[model samples]
Each structure stands twice: as C-alpha cells, then as structure tokens.
Target: MSAPDRQSSFGIFQALRIRQHLVVMAIAFAAFALQAWLFQHRLDAPVPPILTDFNDYHVVGRMVAAGRAIETYDWPTLKLEQIVQTRNWSFMPWAYPPPFTMLVGLLGLLPIWAAYLLFMAVTWLLFYAAMVRLAGRATIPALFVILPSLIINGKGGQAGFLSAAFIGWFLVFLRERSAKAGWPLGAMIFKPHLAAGIGLLALIERRWGAMVRAVVLIAASFAVATLVLGVEIWPAFQKGTSTASEYLWTGFYPLERMLTVFAALHRFGVPAVAAMVVHLTCAAALVLAVALAWWRKARTETVFALTVCVCLMTSPYTYDYDGVALGLAYAMVLPRFVARAGRYELPIAVLLSWIATSNYLWSGLRQYWYGVPIITHEMQLWTISPIALAALGALVIVVLRRPARPDAPWLRAYSWMAGRKPG
Candidate 1:
C-alpha cells in the first residue's frame, strides 16, 4: 500500500479503537445502572447477583441509621427478613465500627440508587486516576478501570476501587519520598484487610513515621467511632469478626474455610490457639520478606506487586472481585516486565491475568455447579481464597529468588519465560 493509504488505514483503526472503548464504557455504566435499579426494585426476587456484591453497603447504611451493631449469631437475619415481611425500610445490621458504618451511611444519604451511581463513578475515576499516576501516562487508564474484576467490585457495591486508589497512592507516595508516606498509609486502614500486606511493607522499610501515622490514623478512626457511636461498637465489631468465620462456614460460598495462613490451619481442624500461632508466624515471615526485598532496593512497582500477593497469601477472606487490585498491580508492572524481558513473558502474563480474575468461575463451572453465579464462585476461589493464595505465594517466592543483577539478563529471561515474578 502507498504511504498515505497506510497512514489513512492506521488513523481509521485508531479511531475505531477509541470508539470501541467509549462504547464499552457506556455499557459498563448502563449495566451498573440496571443493577442498581434491580437491587432497589427486586432485591426480594430471590435471584442472585450477576457479577458483583454490594449488599454490605446497603446493610451498613441501614445499621448506621438504626444505631444497631452487628450481632454474632444473627448473620442471616439482617434487613432481608424484615423487608421480606413488611417491606419496611429496616435494613440488616453492620459489622464494622462506627467510622466505617458512618462512612457508608454518609454515602447512603444520597438515595441507595444514587449511592450506587456515585460509588461506580467515583471508584471508576479514582481507579483510573491512580493507574494513570502509576504508569505516568493516561493512555490506559480507562482500560485499567474497565477490567472484569474491577467491574465485579462495582457490581457488588464493594470499594475495591477505593482500596486500589489508596494502595496505589501509598506506593506513589513512598516512591516520591519516604517522608510523605504516612498520610496515604493512614488512609489505607479504612479497609484493613486490603492494606494488611502493604502495612507489612511499610514496617519492613522501617518508615517509623509511616508506621506511627498508620497507628495514629487507626486509633483516631476507632476513637471517632467510639465517640460517635459509643464504646460498645468496638467490642461488637470484634465479636462480629470472631464469629464471621462460623457463619461463612455454614454458607454455600466456596472456600468457606478460612483460606489464609490463619484460616488454612483452622480449616484442617487445627485448634484455635494453634491456628492463631501459625497465622502470626506466617504474617511475620511475610513482613520479613517484604523488608528484605526493600533492603535490596527492589523496584518500586515490585513492592506494590508483592504487597498485592501478600494480601492473597495472608488475608482470611480475599474475595475474587478484590482480585481487581491484583489486576491493577499487574497493569502497572507489566510494561516494566515487558520492557525488561520482552515477548517471552507475554503468554504467562496473559494466563496469570486470566486466572487471577476468572479462575473461580471456571473452577466452579467445571465442577458442574451451574446454579451459582460465575462471579460468586469466582469470589469464593479467585479472590483471596486458597488457590489464589497459593498462586500469589508462588509468585512472591519467584520474586524473592530471581536474579537481582542487571547483567543477569539470562536469569531474568528465564524467570519471565517461566511466568514468574515477585507475586
């Protein structure tokens, strides 16, 4: 083809890609809108959620209004029972301290439908903004936000985007300067499980100021909850956590067993005390791994990637939609991986990305449990459950053992071709 003809074709292709992207974005928003409407109108229809889980936000909103605390034994009887009986505004109880409950409550002030809209939009924007910041470019921001796992979070009304943004910001802050790390790290405590892996990273780096800031922020949030809701809420929340595993076990969700270091032992009939010991030991070892990695000045993005793996490896209930964070981390690091290692690593990256987001769906379907939503099954195993935990653990081990020298290109190539990276 002539040069002008080739240029014309390339321009047309670029235009088509842009149009396709916008169409997808519109469809995503429309899906969220439709889901929100269904949730508002037919929450009692007995049909399960499609690809997301947003019940927690609704429950928390109501609990805040009624000034009720989450109860240990009364898991299934939250607001649904009352709504089923009387169609009243009564909602299920919350399981968090007042600060968290209040935050959701504040979000709830806008009608639930409105809250859902705002949640989707804000999360999408924050996720994109943070990704752009991480990549030092806006080129793939929309692509990052529209990822399947992320859309799942938006569907369920979960705060995965918020978690991603905070974690990304924390990483960016640390990279920019150790001094400013404390504030963003503090913001992270809002979703404790999501931040747990990164917190260990902070501790490993010995950023005392960051550690202090995190502690202070946590204390402040708790203090605010106590003051606003009463001291009874903390004890109530603790009780809720203590008994959460029991309720989960009774549920049909996959990996009802505590699947992390803490829950893994518990699942195998380990005694509670022994399980706690194992959990603490594993947690400590993870912290040490991150600290060692930091000491060696591993790449900044690697720290974030490993932090994500830590979540999978350690958290008790890492859900599949929460795996969106893993995807985000991968997006940030993939370019660097490709730039350093090239096409050899491409296939592994594709496979890992697929499993990271959809493994649960495929696993569940393969088991012939077609009755359940693919996203739900995905939540069970693809999230932070054992399979994900195993995958992430293996990834981290690879990261730690891989060659560190620049001249060791062969080792890097081998590792990449082998489809391994630091978590």
Candidate 2:
C-alpha cells in the first residue's frame, strides 16, 4: 500500500469513530435531560423523596444534625425509631461505620436535591473513570450511560458506581506497579467486606505499596471519625457491626435475599458455623485462583474479574443493587473475549444488560409480560433467572479459561484491548 493511501485510510477511520462517538453522546445527553426534566416537574412526592438506601444516610445525617457523636451504635436505632415510631414503617438503623456516617452528615449540609445530584455526578464520574482506566480506550459512551448496573445503582441510590470506579482505579494502579495509587480504596470502607477480597489479591500479588497505602487510608478514616465523633463511638461501631449482622441474618431487615451461605443457613435453620465454612471456602478458592493467575502473570482483565467474583461470592448480603459491580466485571472479560471474535459474549452481555435494566429500573415499563400472562410470574421467573444464570456462567468461563501471557499491558483506560496479553 502507498503511504498516502494508508494515511487517507487512517483519517477516514478516525473520522468515522469520532462520528459514532458524537451520536452516542448526543443520545445519552438527550436521555439524561429527559430524565432530569421529568424528575423535576412530574413528581407527586416531596422533594428529595427517599428510595432504597436513603435511610442509611438519613439516620447518620440526623445524628450529625443533633450534635451527637456518631460513633454510638444506638444512634442508628435512635434515628430509625424516631421515624418508625410515628411513621408506622419499619426503619433499619444506619448500618454504615463512623467514617461513612460523618461523610453523609457532611452531605446533609446541602439541600437533599443538591446532595442527590452531587452523589449521582460523583458516582457516575468515578464509575466511568475506573472503567476507562481499566479497559483502556474501549470505554464507549453508550456502554457507560446505558449499562443495567449503572441504572440499578442510580435507581437504588447505592454507591456501587463510585465503589466500582475506585476499585477499578486501584487495580489499574496495581497493574502499573505504582504503590500509592491504591489509597482511593479507603473510600470503599462503607462496605468493608467488598474491600477484603481486593485487599487479599493485592497482598498475594506482593503490591506492598498499594497494600500499605490502602491500610493507611482506612486508618486515616478511623482517626478522622474519632476526632469528629469521639473515641467512645468506636466501641459502639464494633457492637453495631455485630448487631447489624445478627439483624440481617435473621431476616429482620426488609428485602432479604438469602443467596449467600450465611443467609441460606439462617433461612433453612442451619448452624451459623456451616455458613461461615461455606463462605470461607468460597473466599479461599477465589483468593487461590487469583494468586495462581497472578503467578502466571495473567492480564489485568483477568485479575479484575477474579477480584469481583470473589467479592460477590464472599459477601453475605449483596442486594440486587450491588450487582452494579457486574458492569465492571463484564468490562474486564468482554475485551479479551471480543478479541477471540466470539459471537456469544457481546450479545450475551447485551441481553443480560437488558434484563438488568428491565427488571428493577425506575424508568422501564412494567407491563404484565407484554400484555399476555403465559403462566404469569412463573414464566417471567423462568425467562429472567435462566438468562441471568447463563450470562453469569459465560462470565465465569471467560475468566477461568483464558490463557496467560507475560507481555500484556496494564489497563489504563476503557478499551477491549487494554491489558491484552499476546497469545
């Protein structure tokens, strides 16, 4: 090929890619604008209407407002009872630790609407930033805005977006062999168990700088909590953790899903020890798998997939909203599979994403199985469950079966080819 012909071809390809990006961005902006407008003008409820996890923040926010040191376990109950006693609705006390409580309290300084906006913006930004960093250049605008996990996170008022983003960045930093880059992980301590799997992976990989910085960041959070909420609150937090565990296991909370070993045992009247054993077994397997992969020097995408799978499997209480991590998980595996030119992975991803968006999102139609009830809820369950399971199976296969290579790039931004190892 002539030099001029090659240059012209490259220019045409670049222009086409740019055009596609613009189209995607335009569509996403329009959708977001429509959503915002509807939220603003069509509301029948009060401003800042609480959704799923709003109570968590509300409990802590009120405590901060009342001048009470937030370290007390009783504060969550106090906040819950304060509303529940009069509202005739059950309130689970704020279950987050002192650091998160204080952070939410800070959020309470703004109007609830502003807080919500800030939360969404920060979470979405972090979420995509992490995906971009981990996947390299394949970070599509449509993938960001239209992902089912993203919708779930936004709808449930959960912090999965930010958590996934932070975890993604941490993994990227680890891949780069940078030590201090993992400090952002401390922000994820709101759900300490999720951090556990990732931490173990870092340690196994011998990323001492990342490990040390993560620990220090968490310690700093505790120190700040003590400074603001007092030392006495620390003991209360410990007790609160135990109390919350008991409450959760016994089905005292709303929307209990007992898929975890602990929850399953509690549901079937089995001993807690058995559940703990199962949980430990799964966690150990995950850690071992990740360590083996690291030893073989697998791609960053592989490591990320293993980390996510381990976290979910080990978590005793992963609600549907927490499935937002699946977006990151899918991102990790999708590129490598795509490189293999598989027909199924991307389509399966699209379908699972559809289900993910459809089942629990706020903005979707809830028609009765498309205006026909062919066996009612049973049919719906059959359709959704099998599909979800199949997608999950595909994800697992991709993560476990992929070959290792020594020369893969560290993931730096969202792309199918990021951290790709030569076969």
Candidate 3:
C-alpha cells in the first residue's frame, strides 16, 4: 500500500470514530432532555398520596419555618394525612431529623413551589459538582441527565441528590483532608442511614480527629435546631423515628418500593422476623468487610467505592433514587478500572451502570404489566431485589480483586496516629 493512501485511510477511520462518539453523546443528551421535561412536568402535577416523598420535606420545612417543627412530627399519621389532604397536597410522612427539617425549613420560607425549584436546583448543582470532582467533567452529562436515578430523584423531590453530593465529596476529600472530610460526612446526618458507614469507617481507622469533628458538627446542628425550634423537637423526632421503624417493620411502607435485601425477602413472602435476621446478618458482613478494607489500607477510592455499595446493602429503607450514591461510587472507581482493564472491570462497570439506571427498566416493566396482578407482583420482586444484589456482588468482586496491602503507606500513617508501630 502507498504511504499516502494508508494515511488517508487512517484519517477516515479516525473521523468515523469521532462521528460515532458524537452521535452517541447526542442521543444521550436527547434522552436527558426528554427525561428532564417529563420529570418537571410530573413535579408540576399533583402527586398521589403514595408518591409524595418530596412533599414531606417541603411540609416539614414549612412547619419549621412557622415554628411548628415539633408539631409536624408529633401529629398522628392519620391527622397528618388529613392535614396534607386539606392543604391539597399528597400524604407524606415526615421522618427526617431536626437538622434536615431546619435546612429545608429555611427553603420553606419561600413560596412552596419556588422553594421546590430552588432546592432542586441547588441540590442538582451540588450533585454535579461532586460528580465532576469524583468522575471528571466527562461524566457530568450522562450522570446528571441520562441516569434514571436522577430522574427518579427529581420527580419524587427526594433528597437523594443531596445525599449523593455530600457522600461523593466526603469520599473524594477523605484521604487528603481527613479533618475537613468530617463536615460533609456530618452533613449526611440529614439522612443518617447513609452516614452509618462513614462513622463506622472513621471509628475503624481510628480517625479520632475526623470522628471528633463529625460528632461536634452533628451535635452543633442539633443544638442549633433546638435553640431555634425548641427542646420538644428532639422528643418529636424520637416518636417519629419509632413510627417510621414500625412502618418499615410491618411492611406498611410497601416492600416493592424498597431496594434492600430485607424488603426483597419480604416481597418474596419471607416472614418479617426471618427477613430481619437475614438483613441484619448481611448488613453486619458488609460493615465488617468495609472495616477490614480500611484496616488493611485499601486504596482510598476502592475503600470508598466498596463502602458506598455496602452502605446501600446495609440500609433497609433505601429506594432506587438513593442509588445515586452507588453511581458516585462507580465514578470514584472507574479511572482505576479503565487504567488497569482488569478481567472483570468492564462487566462490573456495566452491571453497576445497569443497577443505577434500572429504574427505566422497572418503569417499562410496570407499564407492560399494568393490570396483571401476578406478573406485576413478580416484576416488583425482581425490580427491588435482583439488580441490587447483582450490584452488591459485583462490588464485592471488585473489592476482592483490589485487596488492600497491610504494608501500604497509608496504613503506616494510620498506625502512627493510633500510637502503634507499622509492622
């Protein structure tokens, strides 16, 4: 072949590849735009009682701003439902801590619709920033727009984006700014279940400074809330927590909407006691794995990624929207996976992405099975369980492949902090 002809052929191939890339990106963007429009439209429409998670936050915020924070949680479920209906909003149980209510209440000072829009905008920005920090600029469009979880979050007015942003940035800055990392970790008190593993990791690593900071910050948040709202807020929150726990335990919250192993078991007709035992056992195993990974000094990104997956598995109250954190975890680990091209890396990435975006699949299944009870029941079971477990399994594999070395420098540094000599 002539050199000029070969060069021309190579150029043509490169142009073709670029065009293909552009085409895929264009498609992804279009999907994002369509999803966003649908989500906004849904937000504008009145939500059903069964699907009013966002309204709960807004109402709680309004209560807090009105100095009725304690009353918000103290109201009986039926009374609360009545009030919600009277106000022409959907029924949504308020179960978050006072700190979250206070934050949302500040937003509630605005008109409800305006507050909703602003809250979503701010949380989306935080989510985008966190993604960029963890995944780089390239992933922003796909994650912020094309990911089904984002759509789920926006449509429901859920706090998943806020949790994702806090957790994502916490993981990114954890190694370098250990002390400062506690702030974002502390902010996760808004959804305390998500912070459960953060505290566990801090304690396991004997990161006393971060632990102290997190405790102080969390305490301060509550203290400020009490001062502003009144001491009664704590007891109200406790009562609400108890009610929430009962709802979860009794399956009143609907097993089909949850993504945890416990809920999956419940949906499959496992008794509540048996499901609880299985769920607690799995949660313990995941926590132990995370502790071991940190103790052995796994790579920061790997440990964070593993923890995020394990966190999702640990909590019984999670929904598909909350899997935004899992998406962030994938982002954290992607560069390493791509660089190494490990044997299972591509499959693992695909599985995680599928799980993160599985809502689209589930939605389609729901549409197809619209009025078929038996099939719909099976679909609910499948959607809530299998993909989540698959994601957890894939994460376990990734963690096993990327085992921490005892002699890693980070362990030595940690040992010094713990007043022990590194072996």
Candidate 4:
C-alpha cells in the first residue's frame, strides 16, 4: 500500500475504536444511573435499612463527634447511639482501628443519609479517577469493564471504593517506580491487612525508599489517631476487635456475607480451626508466588495483576464490595488477556469478570441455599480467596507463550513513560 493509503487506513481504524468505546461508556453511565435510582427508592422497605456496615460508621462518628469516642467500643453505649439511625434493627459492631474511627467520626458531622450518600459518592469518584489516571487511552472502555464492581459498591455504604482507590493509585505509582507507591499503602492503615501484596512486593524488590515512606505515614496515622481520639482509644480498639470477632464467630454476623477462604470452607462444614489453617496456607503460597513473579522480572502488568489477587486472598475479612480491586485487576491486564485477537476475547472477559464480581450484591434476594451436603449462600462459596488464585493461574497461562517483557505502557501517566515530563 502507498504511504497515504496506509495513513488513511490507520485513521479509519482509530475512528472505529473510538466509536466502540463511546458506546461502552454510554452503557456504563446508564448502569450507574440505575444504581442511583435503587439507592434512592428502596423496594424492600420505605427506606434503606441501616443494616449495612454504614450503621457502625455513622454511630461511631456520632459518638466521636459527641465526645463519646470511647463508648464506640462499648456495645451497650454504641447500640444506644445507633438507635438514632439504625433503630432497633441489628447493629454492626465497630471492627475498624482507631485511625478509621477518625474517618467515620467525620461522617457524624452530617445526617446519616447525607453522610451515606456523600461518602459513597466521593469514594466512588476517587476510585474512578484513580483508575482513569492509570488507564489512560483505554479509560472509556475500562469504565464499562469495571461497571459491575462499581455498581455493587455504590449500592451500599461500604468502604470498598476507599480500598479500591488505594489499590488503584498504589498501582499507578508503582508503575512509575515512584516512592509515592508506599504513600497509598500507608493510607490503607485502617485496613492494613488488605495491603499485604504491596509490602511483599517492596521487600522482594528492595524498594527501601518506598517502604520507609510508608512506615512514616503509618506512624503519622497513629499519631493523628492518638492526638484526636487519645491514647486510650487504642485499648478500646483492641477490646472492640475481640467483641467483633466473637460476634462473627457466634453467627450474629452472617458468615455467608464473608468472602474469604475460611468462610467458604466453613460454609461447607469445615471446622473453624481447619478452615482458618487452610486460609493461612493459601495466603502464604500467594506471597511466595507474587514474590517469585517480581524476582524473575515478569511484565509489570502481569506481576501487578497477580499482586491485586494476592492482596484479596490474603485479607481474611474482605467482602463483596472489596471485589472492586478484583475488577481493577482485570482491567490492568485487558490488552494482554487471553483471546486478545480473537472474537472470544470480550465474551470471555465478561464471564471472568462476572465470576470475579458475582451476582449476590442486591438486597431482598434469597440469602440461603441448600445442595444436600453443601448448604450455603450464593456468593459466599466462590470466595474472593479462591477466585484470586484462579485469576493468578489464568494470567500465567495467558502469558506463557509470549516472551516476558518488563513493559506496561497502557498504565500511562507514569512520568517515565512519556519522556518523564514529571506529571
């Protein structure tokens, strides 16, 4: 073909791709609109219940704002505090550490409904914007790719988006090999366990600068928490953890809502001790695999994708909303996923996403199911733990035939990528 002919052909291809993505973005916007509708007009009750994790957050915020911060750990007092919003419905004991209490306490500055909407909306924006900064040219298509996870998170008032934003920016900084990578990890101190992968990656790669900064930020969080809530809040937080664990163990908290390896095994009738042991074993293996992947210098996209899965698998208490990170993981590897050049790619991608995101996020659905020996709930079975392992394995196979290249230009905005102009 002549040079002019080739240039014209390429222009046409670009136009078609842009058109496709625009179509996808439209569908994503529609889905988000539907989610807002559901949140506003509750079908199950005249109003959305305070049964979500937000109840604990709202009540604790009220306590802290009302100078009853210490009573947040005291259930009798906390339950009475919840009566204002949660009423006589079930209460979710505060399971977070003191640092997170500061965040929840800020929510008390507004009414419960207002706080719920604002918190969810802000975190949702954070997650989307953080991912877009990394997604770059593919931002439009990526929106639809992660739509289900976004819908699930916005449907309820949970911290899923906060965690997703952390993971998203953490990857964005890591792609640039910047010290800022650790800053996000430090901010995740409220749910530090979910950040296991980043810590492991830093140690394996000898990223001392990033690690040190992360430690400093963590210490700062503790200092701020102490300054705001007082040193005694630490002991109260410790006691609260015990109470929360007991409640989860005694079945006051639904095991079916938990998406951990232990929860899956326990649902299938495994003893709690045995299930926990298996979960720990799986987590340890994931750490080793992710470390090895980084050590051998696999593609950064592959390694980071694996790391996202590793983080979820290692976190024992991550719930459905937390699946947002899993969706982000899929987006990271989109250009390189299996069947990339075949007609099956998009369909296969959607299937994998559904398996990762699940379908039990809505309310009023049957919460229980029976299958002879496997009397279990819907999403509680696939468990983010096993699903993460599955994703890790699938990623490895997809890249098995391709030469390992330490390249990830799709993760744009890395200052190094575009001549290091320093964005």
Best by TM-score: 4
Please identify model 2 stretches exceeding 4 Å from their true place.
1-50, 69-72, 75-91, 141-146, 254-276, 341-345, 349-391, 394-423
- Cα RMSD (Å) between model 2 and the true structure? 6.7
Weakest 10 consecutive residues of candidate 3 by summed lDDT: 412-421
Q: What tens-digit string does per-residue lDDT give for candidate 3 at 1-423?
A: 697986776565456534543554466445445544543455456653333565666566766777777777754643464356333444345778888888878876875456666677678778767766766533442353236676667666788889988887776677665677788888888888877777777667677777777789999998998888888888888998898788777666645656677887887788888988998898898888787877888877768867886767778888777877767766655444433344454455555565645654565576666764223333444345545556645655665466455544333332332223333
Per-residue CA lDDT of model 2 for 1-423, tens digit only, reads: 697986776565566555654564466445444544443332334443333454345445655756664442674556554454223223455567888877877765664445556666677667766766776445662255236655555654567776676777777777678885568666678787777667777777777777778778888999998888888877777878788777665456432222244544444555666767776786687778888887899877777778876766577665555665656666676555444423454555566555644444322333343564122222222113223534655665764466632333422122322222122
Clashing residue pairs in all predictions, respectively, total: 8, 12, 0, 1
Instruction: Please provide TM-scores, in order, for all candidate models, with all chains considered together.
Output: 0.71, 0.74, 0.75, 0.79
lDDT of 1 by residue, 165-284 (tens): 777767777767665677667777666766777677777667788778877887888788777777777766776655665544433344432235544455455665676687777766
Return the top candidate by lDDT: 4
- For residues 7-122, write the lDDT of model 4, one tens digit per residue: 77666656654565456446645555665454334423555453446656766898899877888887877777666655444556776878888878899898665677678767
**Candidate 4 colliding pairs:** 61-105
Instruction: Give residue 163's error in model 4 in angstroms.
Output: 1.0
Candidate 1 vs candidate 3: the TM-score winner is 3
lDDT: worst 10-residue window of model 4:
414-423
RMSD of each: 6.9, 6.7, 9.2, 6.4
